[model samples]
Target: MLMIKSWIYCCLLTLPPILGLSQNLKQEVEKRIKAEEMPAIALEILATHLSQASKIRYYKETDIGHQSFECKFILDRLWYSVEFDENGAIEDVEIKMDFEQIPQAALDKIRYSLSAYDRYRIRRTQRQYTLAFLSSDDLLTMVIKGADELELRYEIVLSVKKDGSWTTYEMLFDQSGLLIEKKEVVDRQTDNILYQ
Candidate 1:
């Protein structure tokens, strides 16, 4: 009996993350934070865009083992999320938009890839901008002008089935729809002490 239990445990540990056995699956947790909780450097960078931004909100986001601060707001009739690391260094900025915002070529490629699955539905779409050493002003300029100098990527969250079970995945693709990374999303439930 002891040997059987040990073997089962070992097998479970070795299962792939997509099988829902891994503890470190991609999960994002966000909590709204006040200006006092934000780092000065991050605030300094954000000041440049405050003139045109409305409905601005700050949040601290945690995903897997990383933590970052985010400023979400509306600018130029578009929703934006600017992220910064613990040290207030800019990481990347994301714009929330519909599938129609994606370029035609990229959209075609995305559709072609989705055809591989039996069926899939896109739940969310965000365009990511990453450019190293770009000051906040420069970043805002690029965003406003729709410049192509920045690295643009698409993050698509969709649900697909495998082995008779459905799972959610976050797929990252380059501007041309070339896949950069794919990760399975894990559902994390809040603890309810009353249930225990």
Candidate 2:
């Protein structure tokens, strides 16, 4: 009985350290996630952007400073990727599509939509053209143009609302010097809600 009691005491003492290690690991992951600045709101935002047929193919926690969740999804023959923090905020979004995959009719629709806006002159080089548009209040300025064929990129800088939503009145064009393709890369709120 004495020996048994001693063994039990030893076992109980060991349990605390084991439990502490587990808790420490969890905390570490959480800390890493927060450090990456992943926003929780991004999850809902991304969900709204995907289509009904889109399915999550891969998801894993990244060790990149913060606890980041890298998720890949397939929708409408496009591959989409979203990185989120542990708290579920979106860190970045990437959409991959081929120029040949987009219908010319859809591209035309995108160009026609841009005609309504007043365009300001943008700097141009031999290969690319750029344009800028100011928001109604002149608080936001959007520059749109082309970069390259394989990638369509947009850089936006705008003010954030108190609720964490961005107030963006600017627009960006694709590497083809057209605005139609921008919608294919970025997920809009309507896309988000509809996808959800």
Candidate 3:
């Protein structure tokens, strides 16, 4: 019992710094919300701009530092999710995709990056649209028309085996599949399950 107490004390003192030093952990929680609970403009934007989408569901997502609203649905047989800020301004749109759907160049780069691991499995993949280089309306239009006018990115959740241990990672890649960021997923065995 004394040894266990000492070990606990040691962990309490050392854990914070260790966690802070690792800039590569992802944590989030999401809960379902009604359309009325979200910003009015968000629903208006969806009703006016993305009317073609079906089976829409709303969620309030809380991340490490911020919160956002999300609308997930099926659009033209593709599963898409749109995220909005608290003010209802568009943030990004994500389209779930299969490995075969990713561009060959991006796939090659992603493959090379994961090769360092003993084994890896892609858990989730999404093609993302954002207003980084354009206006929110323009980004929304791109979603409507399926336009590829701007640079593209891929967000992936991956489980990898390294040094005989398995860890989950959240990775972002540019259109060419060059890794933009790589973070370990924390809080749960995986990142937040946005929905069932």
lDDT tens digits by residue: candidate 2, 1-196: 9999999999897988877643333221222233123344554555454445356653646443655665566656645555555666445545554433434664455346544544422211111112223221111011111123223333222222334343333345454435433211122349666776
**What lDDT does model 2 reach?**
0.42
Q: Which 10 consecutive positions of candidate 1 have the poorest summed lDDT?
A: 187-196
lDDT rank order? 3, 1, 2
What is the model-wide C-alpha lDDT for candidate 1? 0.84
Lowest summed lDDT window (length 10), candidate 3: 187-196
Cα-based TM-score, every candidate: 0.76, 0.29, 0.79
Name the best candidate (by TM-score). Answer: 3
Each model's total of backbone clashes: 0, 12, 0
Q: On a 0 to 100 scale, what is the lDDT of residue 108 in model 1? A: 92
- Tens digits of per-residue lDDT for model 1, 68-177: 99989999898898888998877788898897789999999988887778778788899998766687557756876788778789988889876667788999999998
User: Candidate order by TM-score, highest to lowest?
Assistant: 3, 1, 2
lDDT measured at residue 77 in model 1 versus the true structure, 0 to 100:
93
User: Which 10 residues in a row give candidate 2 its minimum summed lDDT?
Assistant: 136-145
What is residue 130's positional error in candidate 2, in angstroms?
19
How accurate locally, in lDDT, is each candidate? 0.84, 0.42, 0.85
